[model samples]
Target: MDTRDLARIDLNLLLSLQVLLEEGSVSRAADRLNITQPAMSKTLLRLRDVFADPLFTRSGRGIQPTPRANELRGELQELLGGIDRLVKGEAFSPADYDGEITLALSEYIGVALLPPLIQRLHDLAPRLSIRTITRIENQLEQLAQGNLDFAIQIAQTTYPPAYRWQTLGSSPPAILVREGHPLTEGEVSWDRLASYPLIRLYISDLDHLEIARSSEAFIRARSPQQGSLETSHLLTALEVLRSTDYFLPGPAYLVRNEQATRGIAALPVPEGASYELQYRLVAHERTAHSALHNWLWEQILDTLRGLRVRTIHRG
Candidate 1:
């Protein structure tokens, strides 16, 4: 129905009429709906006025439906059934899902997370097309525009009303170095770490937002940003760490147990460095009710938890 027509009509009257039609007794309908007799009588009056018909009549036992009320029974049941189906969508199956899903995350985070995550997607949703974007400059704006379904990045301290986010986990960055590096031999201190040139893994999206107790912020406070190399790709930065005395500071938990990180070791940031980041999975309000979006969201969350658990067990 149109908005103006709907505004004048009370949907509850239709439901009350449905119950009254089924029970054929005002008192019985009131009892079923847990309402007082007078309340039920008032509802009947409203229903009559809305439908412009004396829908019921007094019978010797209880009541009898007028012809109009009898006329409404079959259509009312069918309409209500249709509405029920409309509210509850069909059962979701990943195999049936062939929709495209776009996820925005850094390449480093994807390196360790994507393998197991994609494997699950391959097994479950073979027909689905997936695209991952890296070096995201403005994830929030992208989320608002429906360009990205979800973003895995350093969690912000606050978000504006148009967004929704969930914390994936804490992100304490690790100083990744080649195996048998001098830092691996002994305790890592600010001065000891400062002695080596650093590799900055820039998250292009986070540059606009201010993060509290951020790993990069803490390092800037302690030492000069002495980067021998700064790059977007983790593979390239890790290759640099493998060759020279440069140290790469980035997401350690993601690559800790990965086969690609075999020759690399993730050492803790020096003591008193307030570099703990809360990684958030951010999405727009538009996708809040979407079946495919919610399913993929759960899969990403579950896959991340599984990754962390395996890291713990291996440690």
Candidate 2:
């Protein structure tokens, strides 16, 4: 059929056409439906003329829907719901969401931050479906393309103008050592730390030059060692440290959990030798106001506040 024909037809006819395509045979369709066989046949003919495609045809004992009919099924289902919502003025509530949401986050944040928030969301909105994609490269592009609703990352000193950011929390990096490591025994001096092997956690394109520069300055002033064994993940670094006398420097939250610290201890770095890492929630400003986006943003902030309170009380 021509585009002009579709424009002249009533849209409600499309729903009847869709139902006829599903049932295939006119008699079975009429039986399953409340309509008569002749009425169903009339609707099928109308659909054939409207789309200018034989949407279905007779086979041996039963009829079969053609490729076009098969393809229209999914689109029709969504369109029908959209039409219903528009006609009735449907509203969305966080507590009653039955839609799916996608989140992009780094491995560290996904492991240390999202669990409790997701659990709480599950309790509140059991029908909501959430999918998490990790270690997303080019996070801003993903957000702009609607592939990701939100992201969590270490806030950098500079960012593109398209992104809106909110600080979640910040904490200083800490040195982690095995329970019986020599450094944890007594007064661990800077020179004494350098005497043992060091395991470092490597983030994507993260500037380890700063660490190298600081180590050189320390060696120049206090004669400390300046060598490291690098690993890609924090958990692997912790594992290496546990087996050998190696030391690892990473965010405290990752190791603060019971599994990582069962036989590990966080050591105090020498005065003036630490860096602060700040966590930030980022999204495309244009899409940040969507209900799902805002809900995720609030969930993150709430989880961070609870974590802060727990940390303070524990201390």
Deviation (Å) of 67 in candidate 2 = 34
- Each prediction's TM-score against the native? 0.66, 0.62
Candidate 2 per-residue lDDT, tens place, 276-301, comes to: 67777878887754666677678778
Residue pairs with backbone atoms closer than 3 Å in model 1 (clashes): none
Worst 10 contiguous positions by lDDT, candidate 1: 209-218
Task: Tell me how many clashing residue pairs each candidate has.
Answer: 0, 0
Find the candidate with the highest TM-score and give its number. 1
Q: For this target, which candidate reaches the highest lDDT against the unseen true structure?
A: 1
Worst 10 residues of 2 by lDDT: 202-211
Candidate 1 Cα errors over 4 Å, as ranges: 1-92, 208-227
RMSD of each: 6.3, 10.6
Rate residue 171 of model 1 by lDDT.
69
Off by over 4 Å in 2: 6-90, 185-194, 205-233, 270-272
Give the TM-score (vs. native) of candidate 1: 0.66
Cα lDDT, all candidates: 0.82, 0.72
